[model samples]
Target: METAGLVLAAGEGKRYGMPKALAKHGDRLLVQHAAETLRAAGCERRIVVLGAAADEVRAAAPDLPETVVNPDWATGMASSLKAGLAALAGTPAIAAVILLVDMPGVTAEAVRRILGHAARDALVMGGYGDRRGHPVLLGRDHWDGVARTATGDRGARDYLRTHDVRVVPVGDVADDHDIDTR
Candidate 1:
């Protein structure tokens, strides 16, 4: 099955005083880093969800893959997730590996590890020892349920909690530390 990559980079980053997608990591913007990470991880297709400073992000990262702007981004991360998933609905991909733009520590290797569990019925997440984290793999079968439960920054947490989610330990190759501040 073809697994697509969904980058959720629409947050306004209230804590950081700017949009996290525009934040710089090394020489690349966080959103660029996110899309590149997914590409390096071998996702057959990639889509970025932009919000807040959508025009600025587009102008800054002109080479990014397909992008969808979430009109309700001010609401929360859930809106971005919904937008990304909705954009992927027409694709041939059977699953999507979800990543957050602010998480610079989640490397391509970690995403590749999660991609191994991609399936129409799969619900997998990366685990850091005992703590579950980003790069969650959501199969096509659960997209509807995830979209339904995704609301007010919860994203897919509510749906994952009620389902059987396979956790793959990727701490050895990646870190889940998110850049929430300057």
Candidate 2:
């Protein structure tokens, strides 16, 4: 499966009081870490969505495969989802795209496993130890459902909450967390 990397770096990190994507968790900036990890994990195509701090994030990874801007990002994660999906729609070779960004701790191996288990007709998401979180992998066939998420404050969460997604129990706690908010 040709998996693409979709890093949602557009979030303004309202609670973090800065651009969370740039928030450094270690040697590499958060966004860079996510991008480098995805790129290293064999993602043939990579798309990073940038909004509020677009220029900053874009500059962070100038060698990125593709970068799309979500002008409606202020509206929320749905907009970022729409923007990223729109950019990826043309790549038929793409089986699924893994969403990664500014989160503090997912290792590259975790993404490899998630991409390996991605079901053609479903989304991959589940609990991160004690919490439900991201790095959700949505197959190309399910793009429409995820795209329909353009009207809300999330990135396919509302629909995912109701539908049957292939829950990938992240064995690694780091791969299943959202660092900006908590």
Candidate 3:
């Protein structure tokens, strides 16, 4: 079962000032970093969801893997997550490791740990001690439910909350801190 990587890079970054995808985290843009992190973690297929200055992000990071533009991105994160999952519908991926672009601290090791639980019915996420965080692995079996309840900024939180989720501890291997401000 191939686990695809889904990078949600559509946020406008109202708090950080600028599109989060365009934000630089070292030499590469946040979108590039997120996608590269997934690739390094052994995800053979990677898709990036772009919005809120999609053209600029595409121009800035021309090397990004297959990208899907979310027309309703201004609504919230849910749109981007839905767009990314819709793009994955045609692939052979059994699960997707979801990552947020602004989360520059999320490392490949953390994603790899989540990938270990990939399956058609698996719902797993990385845990930092007692706290759960990204990247969340959503199996194909739960995609419909996730998409249904993913409204506004909730994303898959509503669905995951009601389902059996496995939280993999990865604080020692990665950081889940998001770059919310400059």
Candidate 4:
């Protein structure tokens, strides 16, 4: 299926004391890493939602991909998610792999695994052992409902809780840890 990469990097990172999207994981910025991972995993197009430090993040990773600033980002992740989804509205992609900039541990292989199992009628999540996490694949068929229920820091989480999500264990291929705190 044709899939797009949606990176939610607009958070102010209140706890981290800075924009987490600009946080460095070795040589690459967190947002850059996430976008690159998505590209490597086969996203036809990559769209990033920037808010906290939009210009700085863009300057740091100019070639990342298409980016949009979430004016309502102060509200939370839901806004960023909505912005990214909106950016993908007119694309040829049949689905999108949702990624968080704070998740530097997520690797391209994990994304590939998740994409490999995606279906138009189902939700696909990367599982780290017993816990399902990032790189959530939302088929076009379910986008509207997901967007409707997404709010605050709970982007798509509530919707997924009420749906049957297909999990692909990727513990060995990637880490599911989120760098939300110091």
Candidate 4 lDDT at 6 equals 92
| Residue runs of model 4 more than 4 Å from their true location after superposition | none
Which is superior by TM-score, 2 or 3? 3
Tens-digit lDDT track for model 4 on 73-129?
Answer: 999999888888888888877888999999888999999998887666769998887
**Weakest ten-residue segment in model 2 by summed lDDT:** 173-182
Which is better, 2 or 4, measured by TM-score?
A: 4
The clash numbers for all candidates, in the given order, read: 0, 0, 0, 0
Candidate 2 lDDT over residue span 14-117, tens digit each: 98788777677677677777778777667778777888888886676566557888899888878888888888888764455556576646766667766776
- Indicate whether candidate 1 or candidate 2 has the larger TM-score: 1
Provide the lowest-lDDT 10-residue window in model 1. 43-52
What is the Cα-based TM-score of model 1? 0.99
Candidates in order, TM-scores: namely: 0.99, 0.86, 0.98, 0.96
- lDDT of all predictions, in order shown? 0.94, 0.72, 0.93, 0.89
What is the lDDT, from 0 to 100, of the residue 37 in candidate 1? 96
Q: In angstroms, how far off is 136's CA in candidate 1? A: 0.3
Native-referenced Cα lDDT, model 1: 0.94
The reply for model 2, stretches above 4 Å from the true place, is 126-131, 173-175
Q: What is the lDDT of residue 152 in candidate 1?
A: 92
In model 3, which range of ten residues has the least summed lDDT? 102-111
Q: For model 1, which pairs clash?
A: none
